[model samples]
Target chain A: NAGVTQTPKFRILKIGQSMTLQCTQDMNHNYMYWYRQDPGMGLKLIYYSVGAGITDKGEVPNGYNVSRSTTEDFPLRLELAAPSQTSVYFCASSTGQGYNEQFFGPGTRLTVL
Target chain B: AQSVAQPEDQVNVAEGNPLTVKCTYSVSGNPYLFWYVQYPNRGLQFLLKYITGDNLVKGSYGFEAEFNKSQTSFHLKKPSALVSDSALYFCAVYYGQNFVFGPGTRLSVLP
Candidate 1:
């Protein structure tokens, strides 16, 4: 099984451009999360989905959007990208219940100029 | 609110020497703690975790963590450090229906 996968390993976006960071998991986990990692700042939660069609904002969701149409996919959308949004984006999935360890994707490195 | 703290920004140890990476948490109730390791240019990899039952938890790469309830700490330790073990380590706590991660501590095992 692939576990968790992310598309477009690297990308460059102009300011105000729009794009989507695709994430897919073969584990069929019910909890999926999107996090952005910045130098020295650690990882910040962007958005999350408990299950298909159920999404919620996390600590840092201002410049992003997410939709979980299926249990295996949780895509993060970046509309009107800004230079400050340039960071390594990681997608993770975990089984529901309690305090389960997460499986993370390789991550998408985006540069907004 | 749930918070995680890794007091040291970086830790250096010589190969074959015992090493310790400290972590502490602050929460109202029980804390479900986890440790993740990140190599350069890669995603975070699970190292070990403390859910319940045993206070000492063993994980991958010859790593283990001890959870001290009275001290409110869960410190990661290894008997003998390896140069390949150099990486970034993160501490996290499950709280308030979500997880809160620490700033991270970089471990450098010198040869």
Candidate 2:
């Protein structure tokens, strides 16, 4: 059913470069989240949306931006990438509010040089 | 602020032996806890969660976690470890608006 689909599984960017990590869910979930995983650190929330046109900042939202223009898409943007932004990014979606089991995508590994 | 902690950085166990990965959390209101496993070069996968019911929650791949309210802990356990069980384990707590994740613990099962 392609629960969650993320494009450009891997990427490399020079400092100041910009890119977008695309995410879409077929589950028709209402909540979508963007997270980054660094070595020795668990996932850190970057941004999230409860529904189309409703987005919010998460634990670590600096250096990134997100837009939820449609129910099926939530894309994360790296306006000006930095070395510290290099990490594995993940996209997730859940059916209900707080505490719902979230379904995750395979992941996008980004390297900033 | 809501937070999650995994006291151990790494856990080692022999195949066929029992294994435990410790986790603890703190939140203002009722906490919703979760466990996730990550394989090398992959995304985190949901293992189990504690919403409102049973203290013991069983999840995929024969993994289970016991939720202790008094201790504010949700420890993941498996009886008979397999080499395939080796991976990174994360504990998370959902506050009203966000979910906070632990630093993660690496579990290695040697044959």
Candidate 3:
């Protein structure tokens, strides 16, 4: 069902460059999230949206921004990529109720040089 | 605030042996615990979870986790380990419209 999909599986960007990580889900879920995984650091939430037109900051949202224009899509924007932003980015979605088990994407691996 | 911890950085076990990955969490409300496995270069895959009903929750791949409310621990366990079971394991707690994940534990099942 392609529960969740993320684009640009791998990308290399120089410091100060800007880019967007695209995420989409076909599960009709209302809750979407962005997270970055670093070695030994587990997953850190970047941004999240409860539904279309609603976005909120997460634990580590300083260098990133997110928007949810439609129920199926939530895109993260890096206005000024920095070396500190280098990590594997994952997009996840959930049903937004009850237990709220999330389904994740394959992840977009970005290297900020 | 809610927090989760996986005390062990890594765990090793012989194939067919019982294996356990430790995790503990802190939260003011009822804890919704979860376990996810990630293979090399892959995304975290849901393994099991504990909500409200039962303390012993069974999940995919013959894995289960016991939620100990008194200890604030939800440790993942499997009766028999397999080489394929070797991966990175994460423990998470659902709270306040967000999920907090642990630092993760690496599991190595030797044949």
Candidate 4:
């Protein structure tokens, strides 16, 4: 079974452009998260949702937004892409919260110019 | 605040040699530790985790990590390194309600 699937494996956007990174999980996990990975820095959480209709800000959530309409999908939206927002984005899900092992998707590489 | 640290930016080893990737953490109360590996253009994959079991935890890809409470460290180790094992490794700690990852260390195994 495909645990987690992310769309638009790669994308290039002009400054101020908007886009959404789609994420879906077939494991029926209750927890989902969005994270960005930079060159030297580790993964930084952007947004997360514990369940459907519930979402929360992560450490670095300024340029992004997220919505969890159903347990299977949680998408992250970048309202206005900036050079600083160019990074590889990853989507992850877990069956429960609090330290549980998370399954990550292949990842979406976004470049802003 | 909870945080994780990988003191080494890179680690080099020859094939068949034992390898160690250092990791340390700081968090209040109990901590949930994890190790993940990433290839050149792929996402992070769970290697192993220490929840509340034995201090030494073994995971996929013949990788293992030891949890040392006194040292606040969870170092990943492999008995014998393989060329295919070359990749980036990350250490993470879960405290309070969130997981914080370390900067990551690159491991290169030469044949």
Candidate 5:
């Protein structure tokens, strides 16, 4: 199985520009998550979904939005890009049973200029 | 709120020497802890997890972690370190329906 996959491995956006980051999982996971990693810092959860059509904000949900249309897809939307949003974004999925371990994607590096 | 802490920013060890990476957690109830390793330019890979049972839990790549209930610590250890073991390690705790990760500790196994 392809575990988890993300699109546009790298991207550069200008101030006020908007973009969407796509993520998909083939493992039929019930839980999906979006996180950002900054240099010398741990990952910060932006948003998460327990199932299709159900989503919630995470620790750092500001400046980001997410929609889970299908069990396999969860996309993150950035309405207005800022330099602070410049970081490596990762998508992960899990079965959400008994606090299962998460499977992470390769991640997308975003640079906002 | 649950949290994780990796006191050291970087740890250096010589090849073939025993190594340890410290992690301490703060949780109100039963603590569910985990360890993940990340190589350069790659996503995190699960190393081991402490759900319950033995205090000593073994994981992939000859790695193991010990859960100390009293100290609230889960430290990763290896009997003999190898150059390939060098990577960034993170400790995480699951609480309140979310996972809180530590700042991460970089391990440098000098050959």
Candidate 6:
């Protein structure tokens, strides 16, 4: 399996600019997640999807939105980019919750100027 | 709410020496803990997890973690450290369908 894959390995956006970070997993996982990693900080959950067409906000979901149209794809949308949103974004997928292991993507490094 | 904690911001160890990275968790019920490693400029990778069963759980790259129910801690350890073992380690706890990660601890294995 290809595990999880993310697009646009790196991106630079201006203030108020909008963009979408695409993520796909071939493992046929039922749960998908979006997280951000800042310097000197641990990964923070932004949004997650339990299954297709079912999404929920996570701990740090204020500046982001997500949609899971298919079991394999979960995309995160940034309506208005800000400097605070500049961080490395990771997409992960898991078969289920609790003890299930999460497979992570390579991550997209975003820089908002 | 469930949460994890890594007290140290950084840990230093010499090559071939035993290394330990501390992690403590707070949960109301059965604690599901996990350890992940992040290399420089890369994404986080799963190292190991503790759902239940044995207190000692072995994982990738000769790493293992001990779950101490008494202390609510799950500490990652390696018998012999290597230069390549240097990276960032994170401890996490799953609760309410979400996993909360602690502030990462940076490990530097000196050669």
B75: Cα error in model 3, Å: 0.4
CA lDDT of every candidate? 0.93, 0.93, 0.93, 0.94, 0.94, 0.93
RMSD of each: 1.1, 1.1, 1.0, 0.9, 0.9, 1.0
lDDT of 5 by residue, B1-111 (tens): 788999999999999999999999999888789999999989899999999999999999999999999999999999999999999999998887888899999999999
lDDT of 2 by residue, B1-111 (tens): 888889999999999999999998987668899999999877789999999888999999999999998899999999999999999999999887888999999999999
Residue B93 of candidate 4: its Cα lDDT?
A: 86
Q: Point out where model 6 deviates above 4 Å.
A: none
| Clashing residue pairs in candidate 1 (N, C-alpha, C atoms within 3 angstroms) | none
Candidate 2 positional error at A29, Å: 0.9
| Local accuracy of candidate 4 as per-residue lDDT tens digits, A50-89 | 9999999989999899999899999999999999999999
Q: List clashing residue pairs in candidate 5.
A: none
Q: Arrange candidates, best DockQ first.
A: 2, 4, 6, 1, 5, 3
Question: What is the per-residue lDDT of model 1 for residues B1-111, given as tens digits with 9 covering 90 to 100?
Answer: 778899999999999999999999998788899999999888899999998999999999999999999999999999999999999999988876777889899999999
lDDT per residue as tens, model 3, A52-90: 999999899998988889999999999999999999999
Reference contacts recovered by each candidate, as fractions?
A: 0.54, 0.78, 0.57, 0.70, 0.54, 0.74
**Residue A71's C-alpha lDDT in candidate 2?**
91
Which parts of model 2 have CA positions greater than 4 angstroms off? Answer: none
lDDT of 6 by residue, B1-111 (tens): 777889999999999999999999889888789999988777789999988899999999999999999899999999999999999999999877888999999999998
Off by over 4 Å in 1: none
Model 6 Cα displacement at B66 (Å)?
A: 0.8
In candidate 3, the residue pairs with backbone N, CA or C atoms under 3 Å apart (3 or more residues apart, or in different chains) clash, namely: none
Give candidate 4 regions above 4 Å deviation: none
lDDT of 1 by residue, A1-113 (tens): 99999998999999999999999999989999999999877788999889999999999899899999999999999999999999999999999844899999999999999
What candidate 3 gets wrong by more than 4 Å, as runs, is: none
Give the TM-scores of the predictions, in the order they appear: 0.97, 0.97, 0.97, 0.98, 0.98, 0.97
